[model samples]
Target: MEDFKELTKAEEQIMKELWEMERGFVKEIIDRLPKPKPAYNTVSTIVRILETKGFVTHESFGKSHQYSPKISKEEYKKGLTGKLLTNYFDNSPKSMLSYFLEENRLDVRELDEILSIIERNK
Candidate 1:
C-alpha cells in the first residue's frame, strides 16, 4: 500500500460513521452523531472532501447521493500501521513491541498473551 494520508478530525469522524453504516446518505450520517449535530451542508462538504481524497465514493439516487467508503477500515489501518512502523520503528516489529513493553501499559496477563501469540506464530 502507498503511505496512508492523515485525515483531519472531522473527516475521520464522518468516515467512522460511514464505515459503520456501510453506506448512507449525508443526513443518515449526521443523524448518527451526538447531540450538538452538524449542519447538513457541513457534513456534505466533508463527504465531498473525502471523495476527493479517494477515501469515499457516491451513487446518485435522483437528487440525493448515497455515499460509501471506497476503502475498507482495515485496509486504511494497515497502511497507517505500516507508516508508523516505518517512520518510528525502522520497520522493525521487535522495536515496536519493545517500545510498547517499555510503556508499562500491559498487565502480566496481557504480556503472557503476547508471549503466547509469539510462540504460536513461531
Candidate 2:
C-alpha cells in the first residue's frame, strides 16, 4: 500500500471539488464553492498542500495553474476504509459488519442485499 497522510478538513473539501470538476484553476474552484466561500488564496494554498501530499498535480498555463486529482475518489475511500478496519475493527470484516448491524438500522432490503453479496462472493 502507498503511504498517505490523512488530509485536513480544508484539504478534503478542496479535493472533493477537484474530484467533481476533474481539473480546474484556483479561481474556478473558488467560484464553485457556496456562499461565504473561502478566499482564492485559501483554496490555492490547500491545492498546493494537496499536491505536496501527492493527492493532486498541476499544469502551468502561463501564470495560472490547472490542478487535477492524482488519486480517484474510490481509491481514497478504499484507503480510509482499510485504515478504519485495521485501527478499529481488529482488521476483521466480521467485526466491522457486526458493529454496523448492531449500531445502525438496516432495512430488510439492505440486509438482503448484503446477504446476496456474501452468497455471491462465497
lDDT of each: 0.92, 0.90
Q: Compute the lDDT of residue 93 as modeled in candidate 1.
A: 89
Q: lDDT by residue for model 1 over 18-111, one digit each (tens)?
A: 9999999999999999879999999999999999999999999999999999999998888888988988999998998888889986678998
| TM-scores, each model vs. reference | 0.90, 0.91
Candidate 2 residues lying further than 4 Å off, grouped into runs, are none
For all the candidates, what are their Cα RMSDs to the real structure? 1.6, 1.6
Q: Number of clashes in model 1? A: 0
Q: Candidate 1: lDDT of 103?
A: 94
Please, what are the lDDT tens digits per residue for candidate 2 over residues 1-122? 33746778888988999999999999999998888999888898899999988999999999999999999999999898888898899999999888888988666789899999999999
Q: Relative to the unseen true structure, what is the C-alpha lDDT of residue 111 in candidate 1, on a scale of 0 to 100?
A: 83
| True-structure lDDT of candidate 1 | 0.92
Residue pairs with colliding backbones in model 1 are none
